[model samples]
Structures are given as structure tokens and as C-alpha cells.
Target: MELKQETQTYEMPHLLTYYECDETGHPSMSMLLSMISMASDEHSMALGMGIEKVQATGGTWVVSGYEGQLAEQQPVFGETIILGTRAVAYNRFFAVREFWITDKEHNIEYARIKAIFVFMNLKTRRMESIPAALIEPFRSPIVKRIPRLKRPQKLNENAPIVEKDYRVRYFDLDANHHVNNARYFDWLLDPLGRNFLKTHRLKKFNLQYLQEVRDGEKIDSKVNKLIENQKITCHQISSDNQIDAIAEIEWY
Candidate 1:
């Protein structure tokens, strides 16, 4: 995991608003991802690799997956927190980034995240080698193998499951003109219902984005309960014609 010594980091002050918190009063998983994502974007812009710059190259950074941990004491509404991120490393087609959330005073860190990203040709919708100009700006070394994320296994045929459908709202769109990567969390967790959601808290999580969900698309979010493992649950979200994403979570 060797990377450049001069890893550049950027931080921004963020307030956890009521809408960002779930019924339990903790920042929702999706919202936490969104906050850190904003930090990552800002860091890129500061390094002259901003959204416009990347898009101008005829491609965009696409999140392949994210693996993160939720501390027992999660951030709550109305509290301001420090969101931080830095590019870690990159290979030919993959780049790694890290993110964190801490109290305003920079104490009591609540979450830590590692995500994998790839460059894609927008028109062709195919993977492309990450442009050197993009990676070099972050000062992260171009490594032989970027650290890999935990790959989620496919759901079992006999796994007990429940599902629900959701409509992509206008608000889910982000600067990329696609559904923000974090918005999928609501669909991923909603099938568990309000009762299960309120009683449990996410302790560990992983997600893989297989396809992008655009505005006006409808998704079928399915959850498979792992009877042998009380702490683990698997999810698969599909649009009318394709599987959009798959994820797994551990609750305690």
C-alpha cells in the first residue's frame, strides 16, 4: 500500500441537520456518505482536478464501492462536524480515497470510510484508465495494485427476503447529473421497515454500485435476511430492467 508521502487532505465544517438524521437521531448512513463525498469533491477541486476538469476529459469519476465503519456513538442532529478526505492511491483503472467525520473540535471521530473509484467514458459507459493528470494532482502514488475493497457476495437462493419499490426523486440527483451515490442507502434500508430500523444500528457496512440510477427510474430494493447471522443482512437493488447495486450491512 505504498503511496506518495505528501498525501493532500481537505476538510470542511458541516452541520448535521434534522433531515440528515434518522429516527434514532443519528446521522443516516446515506447522509454520512454524502457529507464525506462533498469533502472528496472539494479536495479534488482544490488540487485542480474538479468536476468540470474531469468531465472535460470526456470521463467522470465513478464510485465502484465503499466500505465504512459506524462508531457506537454516531453524530447527532444540530451538531457541527469536521468532514475530511484525501486521495490515497491509484492503479491504472482504480483510485482509492479515504474519508472521516469528527466533532467540530476534531475529537470523538464518528465514522471512517474507504472507497474505490474508476474513470468511465460517459458516452460509451465503459471503464477507462484513470488519467495521469487526475492522479498526479492528488500527489498519491500510482501503485501497481490499489488496496481492494471487500467484495459483497451474491444473495443465496433460499435466503428469506422482503422488497419494496422507490421512485427516483429530483433531489437525489447530484453534481454529476446522476443519482448521488449516497441516496441509495435509503432504498437499501427502507425494506427493513421502521421498527427494525429504529431498533438496530449499523455497525459495519459495504456497498457496490453496479449501475447508475437516473432520474425517473424506479427501483426494486430487496433485502435478504441471513438467518445464520443475526448481525448480517444483504441487499440487491434493481431497476425495471437491470440490477443497479448490491450491498451488505451488520447491525448491533
Candidate 2:
């Protein structure tokens, strides 16, 4: 019943509805995260660890952190895409998973993500060791030896950089009622503008959430291009500059 590292490939049909683009029409960041979630579900189902089975075991998977970067040109709506995922590695408390969004033609990679996950005892809301049965199916040895990603940089209190404002909306709240974690990506990346967004696909990403964003509040987003390789971005939902989230993205 020990969990194993595994890899799975899935074909994701492009849904036009997901292209709720911004002022510049393209796939939105929120929709990209949603598609990644769907791909994760499909990967789990393929390994026979679908939601029903996890619920039956009285435990569930929870995302701890995620890092992803966007490629400049995302496939427009109605384009067929392929989403692939693999169980990279895991330790006692943390599991690492990798995913990619690619064109159906296999010529381009639109996005890539690395995420950390933890198992929770649904009743107690406490972290639990992942069961062997749940992981064995993944069949990935990469998880065993994979190194931890670097933590994102913190903002300096003395040299503060103020950025644009993001207003929370009703739909931004998920079942948990806080701002949906993925929405932060919009605030984090939008400052770069359409040109930067269109020219580069996310080659690597590292993110950490320090706090939460609530409904109806205005949040500020800041970015620092520390070296071309390390792009640091942060989000705070207050004028006082308390960080609600932070992300580091690397472009290819």
C-alpha cells in the first residue's frame, strides 16, 4: 500500500468559456489555474485514486504552495491542449508534483508548474502522512530524491515599492470564502503587461502565501526583477503593506 511515484498524460479540450480574458483578450490566470486543477483530477483518476476513493479514506489532498510561469502566447479558446502531470517526489510531510500545459501539436509548452501538497485528516483538519496506497500508484522515484525549491524573497520595509491596486470581487471567493488562491496570479503577473505576457511563457515558478485576501478589499501588488532569472512579485491587501502572498517566476 505504499505510494509510488507516477506520471500521467491527459488531453484537455480547450473550452471557450475559460477565456474570460481581461482588457486584452487571452486566457486569464484564474482560468489557467482551474485547468491545472482539472488536469490534476484527471491524473488522479487515471491512477485509480479518484476523489471518491480519497473521500472514502477520510482524507483529502491540499495544495500547500504553487509556482508557475506563463508563456507569452497561450492558445486561444477552442484550441485543443494537452496537460501532463507527474508525481515528482515526496517526504514525510511534503509532496512535489509537476505539470505542464502544451499545445496539442506538441510544438510548444504554454506553461509549467511545480506544486507542493499535503494530506489532511478531513475530520481533524490536521496534516497526516500520506498513505502508501495513495502514493504507490504514482510510481515516481523522482519524488524520493527531489530537492526543495528556494523560498521567495521578502519585501524590504525601508525601500518599499508601491504598485497597482486589485479589488476583490464576489466570484473571487471560493468555497473557503477567502480570495481563491489562484486569483493572486493575476495581480502578481498583470503588472508586467500584455507585451511581457505575450513574449514569454513561464519557464519556472516559486510561490508562498503569507496571509489571505478577503472580499471587497483593495490589494496592492509589487514586483522586482532581481536578475533576469529571478522575478520576484508580492501582493498585499492593505495600505500598511502586510504581505498576503508572494511569488518568484523565472522565464525561459
Candidate 3:
């Protein structure tokens, strides 16, 4: 399949707000995801397929999963950065979106991400085919190509070290009353610590959601660094032992 260059580019100006930073004085993983969401909206608007047009078709784009890698920990409160995004490709049921963050000079890439999106019928609340009119403006090919993202592989439980815990927070709930999907990225990546996080940038990531997290319920996050380029993480909510999500992130 022929991969076409992006027809349009969306540039987003980001002001690092204090509330978005973590204890280490850098943007939190959750906040980074928020910035990506903002950039994705701007990209859609540039293509003339803003939120209204998406909803007019009785469907909306829902992020199925994301993979992000950061080169350095972004600073807090005073940095002005540009978030750029482009629509990469789309099939009947899925679409691929790409994003990058660069300093004001645009010389260095602070972070990069690839995401999978699916359209859902607002009324029926089920996955639906992506609308042609909505995708055509992006001008990316509807090719057979799909990203070869790494999948989470099982790890040895008897290993020398492993970490796991459950989380329950009121703020995790979104307007939809379920946990906002992006919050899971925080839980998935936080275990890597500020040391490893500050030193490496994400090269690739793949995530999958299996269940929903509810308000007031505890969710367990399990993580293991299985190899040099791979890490496996999972989220389980409550005593039912239900796995809500799993993700694999690769770093350089």
C-alpha cells in the first residue's frame, strides 16, 4: 500500500499549567494525554471535520488505544510548546492518528505518539463504520497497512522483583461516568519512575482496553519490565479480579 504524506498539519500552542504537573515539577503522564487530545481536535478542525460534523453523522470518534514515547520530561508552568498532529490512515472500522510535540524552535521532538480510533454511534453506542466524508478530507490512503505495534507478553511471576497495586479515585470518572480512558495511561506508565522516565523517550506503544473502571472502585495496576525495549502493564478493578486494560510501551 502507498502511504501518502499528510495533506494538512495542525499546530497547537500549549501553555504548561501548574495543575498539570506532577510532584517532580514536570507534566504528568495524564496531562500529556490531555494535550494530545487537544491536538487531535485541532487536526480534525483543520480538515473541516470538527466535532459538530463528527456528531452530525450520529457517531463520534473514540480512542481505542495509544502509544507514546517522550525524549525528555517536559517542564512545568513556563514553557510554550507546539503540538503537531496529522491524520495518518483509516480503514472501514479504524483510523490511525499521529502526534508530536516540539520546542518552540521545532528542532527537537519532545514526544511522539500513534493512536487507534474507532467511530461509535452516539445513539446505539456501538462501533460503526468510519464515514467517508469524514475521512476523505484528511487525504490519507485507506490502505491495507496497519501499524505493527508490540503486544503485551506474559511475564514470570517468580521473578526477583515485581510491583502491583490498586487505585480508586473519584476524579477518574468522566462525564460518561466511567473512568476516562486516557487516565489508564497514567496508571500504566507511572510505575516506570521519574528516573527511567526522565532519561528515555517513548519510541512506540500499544494498548488495549478490556473492561471499564467504575467510580469508587479500586483498580489494580501491575507492571514488569520484560526486556530492553518492552514493558507490560495491566489494570484490574476490584476484588472481582476483572482486568480493565493492558498496555505495552517500547522506549529507545
Which one wins on lDDT? 1
Residues 1-252, candidate 2, lDDT per residue (tens digit)? 112332334445455453455444556766777678777777788678888798687887777778776677777766677776777778777778887778877689888888887887877767898877887677655345546666775655455454678788999887644567788888888777666676655556677766557788888877643334434444333424677777766665
Q: Which parts of model 2 have CA positions greater than 4 angstroms off?
A: 1-7, 16-18, 142-145, 163-170, 175-179, 187-204, 210-243, 250-252
lDDT score, candidate 2, position 163 = 65
lDDT, residue 180, candidate 2: 74
In order, candidate lDDTs are 0.85, 0.68, 0.70
Error of 3 at 5 (Å): 11
Candidate 1 lDDT tens digits, 1-252:
112236577788888899989889998888888888888877877766777888999999889999988788888899998898888888999999988888988778888889999999989989999888888878877789777889876766486778799999999897678889899999998998887889888988889999989899999998875354478888889997698999888787
Q: Return the clash pairs for model 1, or none.
A: none
Worst 10 residues of 2 by lDDT: 1-10
- All candidates: TM-score: 0.92, 0.72, 0.78
Pairs in clash, predicted candidate 3 = 69-202, 70-201, 70-202
